[model samples]
Target: MSQREQAILVVSASTDVIDLIFDLCEQCQEASLRLLVVRNTDEVESVLEHHEISLAIVDCSTFTDVEYLNQLAAHLSPMSTMALLEEGTAEGMVAVLRNGADDVFSLAELHLHPQLFIGSLQRQLQRVRMIEEVRFLRESLERSLDELKADQHAAQQLQEKLLPPPVRELNHIDFEYVLQPSLLLSGDFVDSIAINEYQTIFYLADVSGHGASSALVTVLLKNMTYRLVRNYNRNSSFDIQSPLATLHRVNRELLLTGLGKHLTMFIGLIDERDSSLTYAVGGHHPMPVLAQGGEVAFLEGRGMPIGLFEKPVFDERRIALDPTYSITLFSDGILEVAEGDSLDEKEQVLLAACGGKNLSPQSICDFIIPAGRVNPDDVAIMTVSRV
Candidate 1:
């Protein structure tokens, strides 16, 4: 409600009191108050039924039963202001105020100095307006929060659709992964694709931040991988099998988008016939762990983060894979939730978990992020094995 807009309902049986209120309203021209004069309780009830009142001034002397005043105060809007005019002592004024009246003034004193009553009325009206404004702002904030949740839900659905399958079998190797975001949208992404009869490619990326902006880069990364596969099929010049070339292309394209964001990644290619695994790393922490012959250790490779440098060099390392071996990759978010006093201890815990024979995406999540617990960052884990 605006400051100038208010309907003042004045209830009094005495014509002289009604006339004095009208005179006071006229004298206080800046108040811009509208008046509704009622003679008795029955008239007050009738007016309240049909119209909304902002301020109600009741003459207590005119009411035969004070219980009716309580009922009238209850029926007024929660933000409405009420003042009582009574011909009584200070104790009577306190009783009237306790009964729901915001303020109470003696009729005798009002007749002597009407300005005091007018000033009190103005203050009560101002408080009422402030309450109304606060209520409106709270309602608006709730609506915005609801809209944001809906948008985040939609984005989450889209990101899920873009995710690679949780489990896949190609040739003699098996691929499985998990992607979980601290927020509704994830910054981590994983993909595995079969390029030919003898080769398959898989990669995991963790964008710098969480939520919508980082999630968008994951989409771009997916599209870039898809386009590279298409180009590899068409032209011999495009080399999707080389992990270093794939990372370099992704870095160049991401920089071209001008998103001002960077990501750590691990891209790898598997050869089914020769049992060879070649991979490159882009500043990813807790590097991919290779488990073979009851031993687990981190892969050897390091480079600058993608989309941050123009001519960054990434090293491609190759290792012979045993018939029964597993390679596990993770985003840094897992280290954040691991229970350890130091970074080395956390890495040891992860290495132990990765070396198990029955390592799965669900197991990794359950071990790192327990039920009823929240993660501080997006978590991603991918495992490729041949057993």
Candidate 2:
């Protein structure tokens, strides 16, 4: 396995030719060559079974079938270099070299000056060492990549566990959501939690960018929401019910983390007693669609994206919820998948999708994303309905 100890193979029919190769190898002790002497083709095959021959020296004059020797050399290690030793004329030597030999050595001249053969073997050993080093580095890189993929898969599983249930019902109101990531990790996130007996808070946020970095922000947002709920329960003065106040708290927390990421979000608080929906928008596009009494229209709200500025103001809008109404919220990724040439045309397609009878998150996803098609961005859908 060491670079200095190279495996060398010498094939010949005459015992004297094999001894000459072994003697030359011994003269070059600095090369540290391990010689494997094989007389016949069967012996060559046997030697190959036990050892990885790095350099093959074939005695062309002793072996009449140069083609067979060429085939045997080809079957050896890909890094193996071959040299032909011919005692005949230059024309015969050229013919043997053309068959497959990397270099040709005059057997008669080698007997007079063995140093010429020793120098050529040393060069072949250097080439073998370089090939082995490259092979080692390639294998190491492949192992590192495999380990990285395993870690990513584990992180994805943890993220999925943190997501809210696909379908949750609170106080006769049904909250349904679907989250699809372009990659293993998603930037879009959704959550619905009942603040009190009569109030339920739900939000869908699309963080700027995709993959692990954006996914990290979702975890921070979820933790912030939990902390906000605890604060509301402990202190009556803390206004977690207000959509604008909730956005403000989230914006401050996101900035404090210094992640340099912003998000477009639609946060809403539904009061079951009053039958009203109070919501705030943070630069979210293709607003939530409200469907009731055969009419469909986008909810009204607009503001800067969260985590962008220190004192950014968010607008809070309150609307009376119809007895039989469905409000569906979507991340901007829906527009990219929608069939349209422009934003306005895409908005129409979305409105048409939500215009008809009440559709669940699964149905909406099926309509927008065709079967056997992949999404280019992270998509999140949340539908809260009171029937």
Candidate 3:
């Protein structure tokens, strides 16, 4: 196989300097030096455009003007500049170096240190190749990122369409909740549907994973929840009006799909007649902390997470809803928050944020999610208030 050739751009105003540069570049063991001789500095830019030129040798002996040298250095970038200086032009040599020369070579040094000159030229060529490679890779990465963003937008639109509204109005009471995904899309899904005039069933499910894969399952969950709730609400002679059964069913549906997916959920049934709350949870974290009148405690129920085992049993728990209590549920991404000067310290800081009075779900999330808590995963939070 033929090794790829390395290119060098020799820009000189003097015939003698041009000759020296060509000799040095050609003598180098593995360089394809191309002579780009221009009497004027303006021509350097045009020649650079035509050739896959890497290292640039600017002959100071050819041009008395320093501005042209500056322009050449600026256009060529820093990786490929070699300034040729006359015997007494120390000031000019310094100026070229300041502008952005890789190395300034004297006429005598070019003659005596032929190997050194060739080595410098080869290094410049290598540097230019590296720069070009990095530029190509960066542009490719940016293009990939743009395509990903477009796909993410489409996924978000699909997920939003699948979600029921944040708040649903019922006959005797109104249900309101808020959901925020840590990433472009979240695994958290919430829905509310009317079963009867006096009773409504609602639940929040946090699917495992983030991004597109986690988001696809949301559509299925939304359809299944609405259908089951609506069907149950229509029948009056139903004894299984509990959150555990709902989660159990959701688990089965998820498992049957064979997508290797699972979810942690808090499903609830609210009876408007006595303001009673019945709910079940499935291996979820940051358990619903029900708070009222400055008192807060974690809500708990027993159930294996959906889709883990073939047939899992769930426990349904009941609570009395007073005027000021609120229910909060969250995904694991919240626990994975980053903060502090280093980032990991912020997670510990959130522990303090969760402690206090007059705590609402939104408040807890806001305190924990600072501007710098950008990890690669998704975070989600949802809440329902009984007012």
Top of the candidates by TM-score: 1
Per-candidate Cα RMSD to the true structure, in Å, reads 2.9, 3.2, 6.5
lDDT of each: 0.84, 0.84, 0.71
Candidate 1 lDDT by residue in tens digits, 112-187: 8889877877777777667768877899889998999999999899999999778988776799988778999999
Number of backbone-clashing residue pairs for each candidate, in the order shown: 0, 0, 1
Error of 2 at 141 (Å): 1.9
Deviation in angstroms for 2 in model 2? 9.7
As a whole number from 0 to 100, the lDDT of residue 325 in candidate 2 is 92
In model 3, the worst 10-residue window by lDDT is 1-10
Residues 147-227 of candidate 3 have per-residue lDDT tens digits of 999999998988888777665666544555456776888888877766778777767778888777778788788877766
lDDT of 2: 0.84
Question: Which parts of model 2 have CA positions greater than 4 angstroms off?
Answer: 1-5, 12-40, 43-47, 60-64, 88-99, 109-127, 236-239, 370-372
lDDT, ranked from best to worst: 1, 2, 3
RMSD of 3: 6.5
lDDT, model 1, position 95: 71
lDDT (0-100) at residue 141 of candidate 2?
Answer: 86
